[model samples]
Target: MAKSTLTPELAARFASIALGHVRREYPNKPDHTLAGPQDAQTPSQLHPVFYGSYDWHSCVHSYWMLARLLRLFPDLPVAADIRALFDEQFVAEKIAVECAYLAAPTARGFKRPYGWGWLLKLAEELALHDDRRWSERLRPLAEIFAQRFRDFLPLATYPVRVGTHFNTAFGLRMAMDYAVVTDDRDLAALLGETGRRWYGADADCPAWGEPSGDDFQSSALIEAECMRRLLPAEEFLPWFDRFLPRIAQREPATLFRPATVTDRSDGKIAHLDGLNLSRAWCWRSIASALPECDARRAIAEETADRHLAAGMPRIAGDYMGEHWLASFAVLALEA
Candidate 1:
């Protein structure tokens, strides 16, 4: 298969859909949260709350989508609002510092932190925006993250083991961004070491296991991309190559599996299956990073379009659906 090409018309169309969806789907309140429509019954129906309450993960993911939209279409109305959310919801609350422990309490209750990386990445993005308010906001979080690195490293959760890499990478990325922003070499070096250790020995595993599917792949790739940005080209390139093939071969059905299993006695997939979007999004990210190779592009486009068209809602933090939109938009626009 030849690599699919993206025309301006197609790119515009995808961008339009992405922006429109974001505008229509996101709530209009100043709280900066996206709520499910009145008709929404299931968890997936809620725009941003698909993963639960709007926390750092969903907020950061929304920030990324908004940033991407701003990059492609600067005139979009939501850019300022998105920036404000980053400042108020994430930066103001100091979620990164207050919620630094891996076992912090969520809006629901005590839940393991699986998406700290996304939060740190958001901080990096905020730093790039170069606003003084954001700089003051992020410094304390960075310090707290630096101090609490060891506390977060050893917690046992499914993705925490492999996923911590993403958090660590973001922490380092934020540290670097903060360093540049504040011109503090000490902060830079500290964050640099944090990134190095996260990508180095802390995140490595004896078994480079195949991801469960696209969502898992997407989650992994987010961390992988962070690593690529922070680490030397040689150290992480092999990791990318090793997993690219598996990501290319991922199937759409893998994403629809239940999110949690209830009973060992009954060998059936659980209802929570639809919630796992991180893997799918990670797979899309991996595909986007390839060199526009024929097979790679086909998989990327087909996978992205098929998933989006298959009733995947564009909710924040719903990694499966969000990544489907994000990856496709990136490939189409960048093509």
Candidate 2:
């Protein structure tokens, strides 16, 4: 397959805005170190979403963005700094475990895991670059993930399906990546079955009833990628060709709509607006999977250009929304 070319103008713009946001928001540190006043602010302080604060899922997503930037513009000094920030702030063993397995935060705020699959997916990318130490460190988390899949198998018997989006998606991604690394057929089979049962025959649409916007699109992309690796090209190609365009067209509005104000009983309008970049990350997955497809190619190019121009701060609050920035950067750079 031919590589996609990265436009110099776009690269500079994305790197500059991303770096500038990091510098301004995290002043006094080259990497994303949080302390003092920055840490004291509410979760909404960082983004429009109330669940952004203390959500490890969001933190991992931002790390994905940084990792992509590092891969795309490795020669840039800012890339090195962003890499350091990811190492220091995002990529930790305990952090991964907490976000992937724990359940305490759902009671405190939103019930979503914000896009944790991207973290494991990013870990796989880092491992491919010969960073075996981190990859090895990430293996146990995959094991924990495997066990979770075992527990969630009986869709009808499972206690609740509505809130398991992050869990199910992360579990499938980690299990498939784990199978690749360890050559475990059991894990692969488990992942394949889960994908088939929940994501349709080709894993094109929602499998377990109706899923939210992020869950539906992101899970489809992850399932499709995993199945592509395991199934014959002929078996998966038709579905990939059919679904990529639909996802490309539907994702924008599902993700970037302005927050609507809701009337509270106390006669106050609650302002609700923020960009959730997970859709962008899903687009990145689609782009990565079918780089040759025309519609997906155009969507990936246009979305990356828009993000580079937006200059939104890429942090935990913006993690779910902006995690795609890195995946897009890697796609563009490698293209």
Candidate 3:
């Protein structure tokens, strides 16, 4: 099969999937902490802008995907709808309330690294658009997460090496994209330093614990992708060598294979679909860093194609996977 690329047709399809749910507030799974009866509020009441797509983080990244689609395919028929939605949702008052929610004492670790990283990524994408309205309105909320990273990374001496939302490497990788775009040199330096500190010495990753029941990421591949983004080419190449030295031979055979998803309707089991897509993202990115003649380059390219083939077909189906799979599909195809 041919590699799955993000054409305008695919962008529109993804946009339609996101637009269908980003505002559908029902069937919500909130990552909320209710302090009392007074704190009992609907998802829309608490998170006006991000109250759909099953949960807050899913909503946030779905917005990110929509913003990205708008930027990449501005002439798509859905572009006007996306712009109108952003105008309606990213107003100053609503954003201020969202910022206040993040500042609440009870929400100190509400979404932690995962949601925090994605929020910054949304901020990054919004800034790319010609209109400055959305990015400016969202800046305060983004800054709160940026500051959260500044305060949290120092205390986080160890990395969460899981293929799930809490994975520290995935958080760092996404946040680094924002830091670079915003030219926050201090934040950039801090993220790079924290990445090296946590993963610099990680050699010969056995990848023994991948495809865990609820994992949506590949811990081993994401770590390499993280290093590729955080460190310079000369530095990351050697690190990649020590990290997954047998890529050419595919010794850690699991990394080359796409994960199987038996049931897309089961939320956690559905994560395997995301795992496949995200692996494609990582493989494509990691391959770009390799020289043309390198033996691993071809292997990485082929594996990415296999993963994309497996994952793209399942981007939309049951609500469990449909709520968020398109975002990972965007990452894989765009990468």
Model 3, global lDDT:
0.93
Backbone clash count for every predicted candidate, in the order shown: 19, 9, 0
**What tens digits encode model 3's per-residue C-alpha lDDT throughout 183-294?**
9999999999999999999899899988788989999999999999999999999999999999978969999888988888889999999999999999999999999999
Write one digit per residue (lDDT tens) for candidate 2, span 106-133.
2222222234344455565556654455
Clashes of 2: 9
Off by over 4 Å in 1: 1-56, 60-74, 78-115, 154-237, 240-280, 311-335
TM-score of each: 0.47, 0.52, 0.99
Give the winner by lDDT: 2 or 3: 3
Query: Model 1 over residues 20-118: C-alpha lDDT tens digits?
Result: 333333322121222335333332232232122223343344454454455555555555654554455445444443443323332222121333334
- Candidate number of the best TM-score: 3
Q: What RMSD value applies to candidate 3?
A: 0.8
Candidate 2: residue pairs that collide: 4-335, 5-335, 198-207, 259-272, 259-273, 276-321, 277-320, 277-321, 278-320
**What are the C-alpha RMSDs, in order, of all predicted structures?**
9.8, 9.3, 0.8
Give me the overall lDDT of model 1.
0.41
Best by lDDT: 3
